[model samples]
Target: MPRTAAPPRTADLQARPYKPGDKVVAVVDLPGVPEGTTGRIAVADGLTWRRYWVRFDNGEMLGHVDQHALVRARDWDAFRHARELERAEAERAAETSAEADTDAGGATAVAAGGATVNGVAVPAHLLARSKAARERLGA
Candidate 1:
């Protein structure tokens, strides 16, 4: 099989826009540093391959951390709020679409043999198995 080339890393000059003493929160887990760990930028290094040296509150001093792994502490709460609103809107839109489909002449109506998922027939046994799995997993 032929392998596809990885996406090129573009020069993101804005990556390490943080200055020394700027507060940031980890977006991903680092070695000995858990996600959401608040830290201060000790040093912002590199140009094309921007990285940071952070002094975390949990006593982890990590080096070469990229901007993708951190978010400005001031903006974290606003970012999370925006993301939650987007998700709730998406769920409401999906529910509205599903209801419209059901009301429009039984497009989503189930047949006698089994349940339908997105209008596709699912066997009764498979549906039962899925229900059992969900119950077992407490989902």
Candidate 2:
């Protein structure tokens, strides 16, 4: 048997604290990015420096942002609280609408081939699709 040489090692991989879906804020402007822009971590690579990809609030996707270039989003706690409030509001609205629909003598109203519950005009099918999308995105 012939001896084989070992493959050359590249950069050492390190584990990053942030993961996909984590909210982050840009600490330094790079190229088109400006400081203070909020974004979400789309991809995180621990193998190389500046290997993360960020999708900014303005719809710009930038890659290779180093860990030091970003920080956890400012007001992260407030953002979470706001989302919780929104979720609660949506739930309450849905409940109230259902109650109203039931109070209308159990009459099922259909408009343009879509069922109407309360005064909300959105189609049931569309609402289901939107709910599915939100669940998939973990939003």
Candidate 3:
């Protein structure tokens, strides 16, 4: 009997991180893109290009962007505060779960404290802070 290989998972989730409701900034325009601004990123993804997507706050329009051209996205203060709150909540959960498995708390903490960038572990707080600070400054 021949052995079968697993299917490849080609998700671009490794590219950029954006929540369904989060606002983003557009960095560039690809003529190949459908119809959106070059330098400006719209918040919603409804009007986005190939792999790039964003939706504005008012929920008016969705922009399509090229996944490759997406150089940067604006991270704001509100997003920071929200993350801090999220971390606190996660820590609390870890504490509770620690009783079931002591090792679990440490593992959770380690995972929560950092995020992966191109498969490299980077401090989540730092990324959050920089984006938040830049957003605050923009406002």
TM-score of each: 0.50, 0.40, 0.26
Error of 2 at 19 (Å): 0.3
* Alpha-carbon runs more than 4 Å astray in model 3: 1-39, 42-75, 101-139
Which of 2 and 3 is the better model by lDDT?
2
Q: For residues 1-139, what per-residue lDDT tens digits would candidate 3 score against the true structure?
A: 9989643221232245444544344333334432223233434343344453554333434345455444333433333444456678789998777554545544554588855444344566887898899999995
Question: Whole-model Cα lDDT per candidate?
Answer: 0.76, 0.68, 0.47
**lDDT minimum window of 10 residues, candidate 3:** 6-15
Clashes in model 2: which pairs?
Answer: none
Q: Give the top-scoring candidate (TM-score).
A: 1
Q: Per-residue alpha-carbon lDDT of model 2 for 1-139, expressed as tens digits?
A: 9999643211111123678998887766876788778899999887555568999998889987887777677544444455466678789999998788665423433444445545545565787798899999999
Q: lDDT score of model 1?
A: 0.76
Candidate 1, residues 15-115: lDDT per residue as tens digits? 44788999998877899999889999999998777689999999999999997777788766655565566678789999999777655424323544466
Candidate 1 pairs with clashing backbones? none
lDDT pick, better of 1 and 2: 1
Counting only residues 3 or more apart in sequence or on different chains, how many pairs clash (N, Cα, C under 3 Å) in candidate 1?
0
* Candidate 3 or 2, higher TM-score: 2
Q: TM-score rank, highest first?
A: 1, 2, 3
